[model samples]
Structures are given as C-alpha cells and as structure tokens.
Target: MQEQKGKYEDLKHDELGIKVRSDDNPYLSADLQQKILQPRRLSSYFIVLIESGSITYHLDSQDFTLTDGHLLFAMPNQIFTPPAKTGDLKYFKLLFDENTLALLPQQFPFLVNPSNAQTLVLDNPAKERVIKVFEILNQLLISDKYETDTEIILAYLNSLLSEFNSAYFKNKGPVNILNTNLSKFTEFKLVVETSLTEQPSINAIAEKLALSTNSLYRIVKEYAGTSPKDYFINRLMAEAQRRLRYSNTSVKELAYELGFNDPDYFSRLFKKSTGKSASDFLPRQDLSGK
Candidate 1:
C-alpha cells in the first residue's frame, strides 16, 4: 500500500487527547495508513509507538528511521515533521499538554531531559506492555462520555506515560557513564535552543557548560555524532525551516532573525545543510487555501 499526500489539517484537540486506528483523524486512516504526511510542529506533546513498517521522521533537523518497537516522543514547541511513511506502518499516538503531565504523581526525568536518541527500541516484553496500555487509553477516549470522564482518562494517561518513560530509559548504554554524558548533552542542547539567537561560539558554549573545549567536543560528538558548531548550525537550520515554511519571510530577513551576520553566508549555509536554496525550498505549513 502507498501513502497518499493529503491536505494538512490544523488538528484541534482538547488539552488531553488520544487517538488510535479506529479514530477518524485525518492523520490516521481507517485502514491504518498514515495521511497528512507533511512537515509541521505539534502544539502539544506527542508520542507514538510504531508496531510495524518504516517512517522517515524529521524531528528538528535530525532524520530518524523508526520501525517496529520504536517509541518516539516530541515535546511541546519542538518541530515534528513526518515527511515519509510506508503503508505497512502501524502505530498508536497520544497527545496531551503540560497540565496533563502535571496531573501525574511523579515527574518523569526522561521528559525533562530527552535522551540523546529520541526513539526507544523496546524489547518484546516492553512492547507488549505498551500495547496493552495504549489499547485501554484508546478505549477510554473513544467512549461517548469522555468529556465528563477526563479524570479517569488522565489517570490512565499518566500510567501509560510512566511505562513509556521506564522503557525509554532502560538498558540505555552504561548508566554510570551515560548518566554524566546524557546530562551534559541534554544541558548543552537546552542552552543552544534557548540561546540560538546569539549563535554562541564553541568556546562560549563550552564555557557555559563548564566543560573544557576539548571535553565539550567529545561530549557533543558522543551524543550528536557531530561537532558542537555543526550541531548548532543544524539547530538554526531547523528553525529556519520552521520560519520559512510558516511565512513568506525573505532570505535576508531570516538570516538577521536567526542572528547571522551575513545574509549571503546564511543562504549558503542553508543550502549546504538542506540541499536546497532557501528561496526554492517549499513551505509545508501554509494552509491558507484550505
């Protein structure tokens, strides 16, 4: 089966939302083939468990090939674009807001600092447990009286997320060594995201992270498999895509907005990183005609 490119929808859901194969969502079809495969961001936190097939998923600037047993997560304000999909793909998705996360008794550390790798390749046992939880939540949401039954929905949501968080953090490298590596990497990413406009130099970033320049290099390489400079550039490029796709801003304007000193350089960099010129790169989020 092949996926058809459907019209994009600005899907509106209540704060706490759930959807499974049986739902009538534009993103999910009756036959379980994905529609609305486009580049866009999610307003709410998004999680999906893939049971089969492949997905060329673009989260920020990184492209991840997710298949069966993979659980992918996207925090709010993060850009998530499902650019390509296979007809064989089967998945369950859950979307919720910060308030729903707060309803849980304990905060999940994985949510606070997403691992270096966003997708968790779960073991068979873990996959079965996740499937069971998702089924129950799906049943709750599709219930006729769900509006008044939000508390029960939320309780199950918390439990489902807890299971996901546990599976995501399990057997992830050597925890003793990875704990430090993961923390430093997570902190560095947050700083880059928050201070991306400044376009901080490698030295500045290393100093802010309180690591020696050489140490910073290894840490970034360990997590991102790229130099800090390249990683930051990629981050900027993802932002560039978001802005360009959402509006008709000129190339020069985009450069300045992202704090690049030279528009020409920004244009070259964008083209180099994305394999397409900024002007020629098509927008995916503009749905005014719809």
Candidate 2:
C-alpha cells in the first residue's frame, strides 16, 4: 500500500486532526507507546514538547532523556530512535519543514539567532500561552476562516515562537565554559560549512584560528568532545547527504565537487562513515539497507 505522504493525523482519533494541524503540513508526530520507536529517516523538523512522562532519544550515537516539561529540536533528514520503553508518554510534537522555520526568522529574529540555546519548559504560564496558540490554530483549521491564508497563522506562530524563544533563553543558566567553547564551535562549524567544497584541512583551520594544529585540536576536543577530523567529516557527510537526497548530481560529480580526486575513493569513504552507500541515502533511490 502507498502510505500517506506529508499528512498530519491525531493518533488518539484518526478522523480528527491534531487540535491545530495545518493542511498537508510537515510538522507533527503520532504518539508511540510501550514499544520503542526505531531509527528512521524523517523529511521534516520535529519540535517535541513532552507534556507528561519520559522518553529517551538516541541520535548521532548520543542518548538524551526527555521528561515532563522538556523540549527537544531534531533537524530534518536525520535518523532517530526512541530508546527502551518505560511507561505511558504524552507529547505535543510540531513537525515543520526547514523553509517554514526560515520564514519565521525575519519576523521573529530570535528564532534564527544561534545564541538562543534554551528550551521551553511547560510551566503554567508558558503552557497556557502555548495551548492558547494551539487552540487559536485549531479554530482556524476547523473553521477555514483563514483558508489558504497563512498570514494569521504565521503571525500566531511567530508570537508563540517568540514566547518559546524567550523561555529558552531564561532557562539556560550562565555557563562560563560553554560561552567560550561555543564561540569556538560556532567558528569551526562556520569555517567547515563555508569551506567544505574546498575540502579545507585541519592545518588550514588551525591557521585560520591563528593557533598551532596541536593546540587547536586540544581546544576543540575539550569543548566539542570530538577530534577535528571527525568533526569535519561529519560536516562533510552532512553536505554529501543533503546533495545526495536533494540533488541530481551523480556520485562522481559530487565527489569532484567535494574536492575528492578519486570519486571511487570518496564513495568508499562515504559508505564507511555512514554505513550506507551514496545511492542508498537518496530518497529517490531506495537502497534500504537498515
């Protein structure tokens, strides 16, 4: 059977859309219970707000525990799994495309600000505001009062996100260590993101930082908990994945564009790093070797 694509369903009631579901939207989740939700690919971002109970999230070989009032943001196109089942869990999840978020930044600049690392906790006041926003959206969705007109919805979304952004900033306490380390990490990610096509080396990054390679690696490891090479490779693989999934560039072309002299070697490296071949990662081509 062909599955539903880009449809949001209220898990508790199939006929009823989640209180505030958008038309053919990209953002939302079906409640999972008892059993573990295995690792799988998703095409949209997930903003998970845990209302009650607890859930464990496993991503990028890291484990995070989310309990009541906690929130998490998961980027699109990544593999995620809900680790070992505990008890009943209730969550309000929003799944939106990246473009939807992009559209938000201009109106609510804080949404796009990288420095806002805090997440919203479900306090009475905060919860009330969020629920109110959802309620308004529900009315809009059901009434079709703003049919095909996203301006009102978008305005409400921005207001909700602004509140969320504020809460996030407040909950995160002053961290001297993170403040310094984050600066380095951001610079490193920026350099790698901007220079990946050139395939900049560790030495090159160190030079840009005006530090010796050894010193730079030590600092990065202290903050990022990963070696420079590993970090850069992760960045590179991310780019490769994006291109593979979203573009028509052949493997050879991708390799060349990524500054690999030998496309075959790039292919092998990519497979080794991700445990999936280039063709397999693309949504269009189903290698499905999970």
What does each candidate score in C-alpha RMSD? 8.7, 10.3
lDDT of 1 by residue, 1-290 (tens): 01222322332224444545412333445343333454456766777788777776777767788788887888766767665445756777777766556555655556644445577778898788878888887776666653535556656776777787677677765564236766787778778877988998899989988899899889888767899999899878988987887667888898999999899999999999989899887545453412
Instruction: Give the runs in model 2 whose Cα sits over 4 Å from its true position.
Output: 1-38, 82-88, 105-122, 138-148, 171-231, 234-290
Q: Best-fitting candidate, measured by lDDT?
A: 1
lDDT of 2 at 164: 69
Each prediction's TM-score versus the true structure? 0.65, 0.51
68 Cα displacement, candidate 1 (Å): 4.7
Worst 10 residues of 2 by lDDT: 9-18
Q: After superposition, how far is residue 161 of candidate 2 from its true place, in Å?
A: 2.1
Error of 1 at 183 (Å): 1.8
Clashing pairs in 1: none
Candidate 1 local distance difference test against the native? 0.70
Against the true structure, candidate 2 reaches a TM-score of 0.51
Task: Report residue 149 deviation for candidate 1 (angstroms).
Answer: 8.5
